[model samples]
Target: MPYCPPDCSCNLDGTVDCGGVDLKEFPRNLSESILHLSLQNNALEVIPMEELSRLQNLETFNLQNNRLTSKGLPDDAFCSLENLLYLYLANNKLTVAPKYLPKTLVSADVAANYLTKIYPLTFGQKPNLRSIYLHNNKLTDAGLPDHMFNGSDGVGILIMSSNFLKYVPKNLPKELFRLHLKDNKLEKIPKGAFDHLSKLRELYLHNNYITNDGIDNETFWKLSSLEYLDLSSNNLTQIPRGLPRNIVLLHLEKNAIKSIPGSWLTQIKNLEYLLLHNNKIKAKAIHPLAFKGLKKLHTFHLYNNMLERIPSGLPRRVKTLMLLHNQITEISRNDFAYSYFLIELNLSYNKLTSPKIHPEAFRKMRLLESLDFSGNNLNVVPSGLPKNLHVLRLKENEINSIPDGSLSGMTKLKELFLSNNKLKLNSIYPGAWKQLTNLQLLDLSGNQLSYVPTDLPESLEYIYLQNNQISVISENAFESTPNIKGIFLRDNRLTTSRVKEIAFEKLKFLQVLDMGAYSESATESKKDGGTSGDNLENDSEQATQNDK
Candidate 1:
């Protein structure tokens, strides 16, 4: 009796659920005690194989995403499923690598497919073959043949990422442990290419064209149970002299790496996230004890490079320090004297200038929280920072003034960028932002201001003040913020009769009022739709008359 094909599903333990059923073929009534068969995502282009060779007690044969090819799989088609153990032909259109695989396969997903050749005894010595997903396929290196993973000694995870392999893939499989050759045209790494794997552990080889004399100083000296090593972007100019001290996250960013040898940070002293950003690093070729013995390092990116300072013996439990852009002109006060659990400090752009900061610079960080110092050439606002700051960017720079207590001990400042710079609404001072009071976003766009800056801080909610020359909108200018909601003041020199149309009627939860070049008198005061609260008529005057 053969009766379940209305988009199949015959169970009772002898499983046979036809998955994603648009079944173009193969589902023709078969229940000879099915053991487990899921024809996955089926527009089954042709896998009839004499009706699946009479399912000899199949044991999990999921034909994954099926437009099955290789001329419809014939010669000894899965050789009568000798009680197969998981063989999902992934993505499908397979070119070759499926010569009836079934030495009771223990996991074989012919990944993504179009497998440009793989012949030499394609899985012939399969003794319970363990995990082999031939990643994204057009695999090169002459279609892999020299002892094609010799007699699979229980191969363990070999995902050949994005192929065309220019090297390293010979006879691998001494029980390999995760070898994903990321983005391939792999340029030379043959010295015992992980000789006898020693149960390898996560080695990605990021982006590939691998250089620096194509790797040989004892390859990786037999991977001592490696732990995550990405070798980012590749063309490697240095730093690859047998790295394998049980590495714990070391992605060498972008490349051209100019010198790092402090005997390579004394061989990764259990490195904890050390990503050398962008590259060309040239601060007198490093080595002031080049990050002295990592000591459980915690995130240090060294962004952009050519560093003109700040690289002295880091790793006092570093907590995120991305020296953005570089040429760092001065930050001394024992420049981060032993990290002290620093928290997020990105010296934006760099050639910093506010008299090179030395008033006890950041005074032992105190668990600092987000301090960027955008662009550079700073003119002020650099007082001994770190009062548990919560984001303080200082955009562009040449800052002219904000004087009065320049942010009296931060008080957990909440995002303050001070846009473009050389500011001048009478150079700020009258309680300059009144001790921030947990200020909520205040950019002060571009610069050369004409007004708007008196004791602001009732926890203001977003105020950018676009471009500048602001021709007054005073009169209770937001009367100490009723939680103002976004007021940008686009382009500037405002008009609608120089602003007092109830100057935003005490904001009332205003929602975005941009007012670019006075938006045609705020669109004729919203076409004269008169209403109370001093008549500028709601929604922040239709958001400054639909801010165009």
Candidate 2:
């Protein structure tokens, strides 16, 4: 009789959780002040007696996914669990291993189950087991369990993912700090599964099929406090030399890693974040001492990666440079002349036609701000931006108009991601952004606007004029402009509208007024209605969302 689910609740320490409920057995009379008990997923298949050691204040008994297999449970069950730590008998059909658990256990997540074998005193009855989730089950690698991380803080997070690991277990346990041997059947990585992690840190060896000859240099001279290194997917083609310079973040996307290893960017040099997308590197495999000592690199993701070019001794103190798609057609300005602390430049999709932007191509950027040349084949819009460039992502390309002053030398231009190009309808060109007076986010959604051009820009906040071809708003259409906080004119088509005198009253900081995804009209030309959605719903944003 184990059916206690009146929406389950019991605080003061006892944690009873009938997780996922679809029960098939063991749900009999709980409430002995449960101290952590989640019958995850449910449909119990036994191990029910000891009635949870007669509620001696239980302490974590999550029969993960239910339907048990092996028994030998009630030797006084958890014998009045003396603060039982955490025992989660993983997914069902257990082939054996469930012997008298509870030895002041610290953590045990018998991953997936179906015990193919595990009898080395099965955790010697939990000698304070410190984090162990036998990933996916069917353990191999020569039937691990010689003393699989003999506890005492030794097993500090070990999830043998997917299992049947081909290697990676040269007796690992120098107090491992977190090691999920991802999707196994490994091709290698043994040689001292990190010879006693020198205080390892976040290492999710992704979908392994392994390569890079299973890595060298004594497998990273003992992870020197590794910081988050997910060797993405895998079958790595190269670049796995001696990597462990206090890695800050290195997710070698997809892998078949063709390049990028000037000795691992000079031994990781506190690398800031380098996600090598796709990969099959070329362009002279970038070698000017490729990122010689990544002086705190700040985000450099090589998008799509087939690279026609863009990699050249890179390290102009990068600050976000994601080269989209690739096969870059060409756009030399000394390729960021001296990068001078480059700033946000994502050359979208690529194969560009003639993106000639050399008016000294940003003269040695003086902290050049956001600049993304959407998709490519840009027909126009390029006037040496960097006069304090703000944000300018020329979406999709083949730009039709809006290039007269071509953004009058961006005097601190705000945000302007010109939505999908070939802009039609009024073709927006009121002096090509009437010298953006500190304009604000203005993504013209997916262009082709029909009407409503009242010259918006008083430090506008956000105005993505939804899809195209409007109906009306032109009572002078935002006559005395400048005060907009947000006004995305929803999905255009419009009907009921007015807005005559003092249109939007100098927008005293109008906050977010998305006209119904685009004129479903019905703010009735809002006069007393829209001060633009309560100007930032105050109260300090409800005390910063209650301190999160």
Among the numbered candidates, top TM-score falls to 1
Q: Global lDDT for candidate 1?
A: 0.79
Look at candidate 2 and tell me the lDDT of residue 265.
62
CA lDDT of every candidate: 0.79, 0.69
lDDT for position 316 in model 2:
65
TM per candidate comes to: 0.37, 0.36
Candidate 2's residue-wise lDDT over 152-210, tens digit each? 44567878888777878655667777889888878877666686678878888888888
lDDT digits (tens) for residues 23-135 of candidate 1 = 88887658767888898998787777777888888989898898988888875788888888888889989887765576777878888988987865567578788888888
What is every candidate's alpha-carbon RMSD to the true fold? 16.1, 15.8
Model 2 misplaced stretches (Cα beyond 4 Å): 1-62, 65-120, 123-146, 149-157, 160-170, 173-178, 181-241, 244-312, 315-358, 362-382, 385-403, 407-415, 418-548
Candidate 1: clashing pairs of residues: none
